[model samples]
Target: MSTILIIEQVLNGLQSGVMLFLMAAGLTLIFGVMGLINLAHGSLYMVGAFAAAAVAGVTGSFVLALIAALAAAALAGAVIEVAVIRRLYDSDHLDQVLATFALILIFSEGTRWVFGSFPLFLDIPDALSGPVTLPGGIQYPLYRLALIGVGLLVAFGLWLLIERTRIGIQIRAGENDREMIAALGVDISKLYTLVFALGAALAGLAGALVGAIQSVQVGMGEPVLILAFVVIVIGGIGSIKGAFIGALLVGLTDTLVGIFLPEVLKLFMDAAPATSAGSSIASMSIYILMSLVLIWRPSGLFGARA
Candidate 1:
């Protein structure tokens, strides 16, 4: 590939990575703080996309759509936390998984009932619809670049929240010792609700942002959810920093491999076979990376040792 092509792919990788970070960050936070295996998290992502699309269709305002997305997802999260998740805290992972998986079905059906079976398209705002030129004459999508910036800013803000603020301290402490914190009068139930809502809002934001680039529809979050899980596992279950780095690694590996692996294989095989093989191998690249990382560090890149 040419230098420009490589640069573009790298930027694409970064964009993908950042989006994954948005999804994975929330997943990690929820898992880290609550020790809950939430399969319904992706449902909240769908909720956001649907909310944003509905609001945007009505108001024609991207900003308002985003706000709606956050509000809707957070509301859904809080409701579930109170109605369902609260009951799962002391339950085993199997029960949590089963309950959340049921939630996924309910969410999917509920969304279909409300939005119908059709996919909705979210338009890019005029301000970010065009491509911009970079220093090396690289033209990139402004909206995608904006996504990267937003993800990074959120990451920074999350770090500050966890490291510098009282709530952050409680979250961290809860992750380490929930009972102790509860004993210390930390209104653990409220904190759990807040964390779940915050995580849901983040997932919703990701869904809304990505919906502009892709179609917004029920079950849209499932695929992304799988990737987010991979990111968290590779990054270490409860580490935001690890999630960020792992997301970048996964995004870069996925994008670069999908594009260049075929070229590399073509050197040794015919184009058709090479393309097929490359595509197959590329699909597993992230999982392979995960396996390798596990071999190197069982707890994940940033996960605390057990």
Candidate 2:
């Protein structure tokens, strides 16, 4: 393959990685701070996509659509946290899992019922509808490039929020000793709701951005949710830095392997079988990477030594 092709694929990987980071960041935050196993997080993502699609269809303003997505998902998350998730905090992992899984069914069915089982499409804004030429004559979609920028900005903002703010201190404290923070006068319940809403908003933003590139439909978040889980696992359960690095690693591995593996195999085997074998392996590359990472560091790359 040509250097240009390689660069393009790398960019594609980065784009994919950043988007995964958006999803993983929130997931890690929620799990890290709340100790809740939320299977329905992805459903929040779907809600955002649907909300954005609905708003865009009615208003023809992508910005408004994005706002709607963030608001809708955040609202949904806060409501669920208050109405259902709060009850599971002291429950066992099995209970948490079962409760959240039920939430997933509720969200999926509810979305299907409202949207009538039809897929919704969000159009790329006129400003971001074309490809732009890079320094090396590489043409990449402007919207995708925008997604990377937005993801990075959000990551930076999150870092500042976690490392440089009062709430950050509370969140860190909560993760280590929730009782201590609560005793110190922090409203633990409110903090939990805020964190959950924040996480859901991030997922929602990701969904809105990606909706333009793909069909917005019920169950769309499940596949991305799986990848996000892998990302957090490889990065560490509650570490934002870990999530970013892990996401990039998985994204590059997935994209580059799928693209180049077959070509490499063709050197030693028939084209057809090489393509088949390459695809099979490519699909498993992220899991293989996760296993390798676990072997090297059981707690994940940035997870506390435990």
Candidate 3:
């Protein structure tokens, strides 16, 4: 029974990892192609959640709300790419960070102004609201399992887009040498917009899916954004495969630690101390894993040697 419990926690971790991968994929690609670090990526995530919540509130249809969420995020991404982000394309990382930092402020205040301070709620569609049993009597929420399926499908679709398409060729080339690729007559401006939109859509989707489980509110993206950064750093920037693996590792580690640590600690200490110690250590597991990875590889598991 204890073993089954551990397995369930591990599954939960994997599910979390799948969600992280969805966010990390877009982020890593944007960084890889544009050499821009977008702190406002989380804001896009928040936007999607709000879009879904608002649309669902009005339409009373979760499917329509999800579509609106993706579309709104993509449109916003493109507009930002044109209006604000393009200005920082040739500037230093400091400029990019500052500019995106301002974006976070704008997004947060703007969202609050529109939605007010209270969080908006999103409901899972009825068809997916129940639980299902897997082998070995493992029970899981249907919606959560659906999210994993959607994430894997998206990952595969992105892989096909990046690895096989003509635009993908340009993206890969740009990553290799941006100036040289432009010299070869590629429309660098359009490519950047597309990449930005793609990343935004992914973030938006993540937000929409997670909103069903958590409340949709302002500044919700920041914590996940930080975790996404850690995911890419550990998985290897510019490597989609690395992001997938890293996200899964992080999700699993976090989930397992959260569940197992208290029990492990209890074996040696009192319940109160064990619980406190377990909670603290579990919260830090991903960062601890990240530090260990850096100490060992410096560049990350799949990162190119720098």
lDDT of candidate 1? 0.94
Candidate 3 all-Cα RMSD:
1.1
lDDT of 1 by residue, 1-306 (tens): 789999999999999999899899989999999999888989999999999999999999999999999999999999999999999999999999999999999999999999999999788889999999999999999999999999899899999999999999999999999999999999999999999999999999999999999989889989999999999999999899999999999999999999999999999999999999999999999999999999999999999844
Model 2 lDDT per residue over 1-306, tens place: 788899999999999999999899999999899888788889999999999999999999999999999999999999999999999999988999999999999999999999988899799999999999998999999998998899899999999999999999899999998999999999999999999999999999999999989999999999999999999999999898999999999889999999999999999999999999999999999999999999999999999745
Cα RMSD to native, each candidate?
0.7, 0.7, 1.1
lDDT of 3: 0.91
Off by over 4 Å in 2: none
Steric clash count of candidate 2: 0
Candidate 3 minimal-lDDT segment of 10 residues:
1-10
lDDT of 3 by residue, 1-306 (tens): 276787777778878999999889889988888889999999999999999999999998999988988998898899999999999989999999999999999999999999999999899999899889989898889998898899899999988998999988998888899999899998899999999999999999899989988989999999999999999999888878889989999999989888888989999999999999999999999999999998988888898745
Name the better of 2 and 3 by lDDT.
Answer: 2
Query: Who wins the lDDT comparison?
Result: 1
Look at candidate 3 and tell me the lDDT of residue 148. Answer: 85
Q: Rank the candidates by lDDT, best first.
A: 1, 2, 3
lDDT on C-alpha atoms for all candidate structures = 0.94, 0.94, 0.91
Query: Would you give me the overall lDDT of model 2?
Result: 0.94
Q: Each model's TM-score?
A: 0.99, 0.99, 0.97
**Residue runs of model 3 more than 4 Å from their true location after superposition:** none
The superposed Cα distance between candidate 2 and the true structure at residue 87, in angstroms, equals 0.6
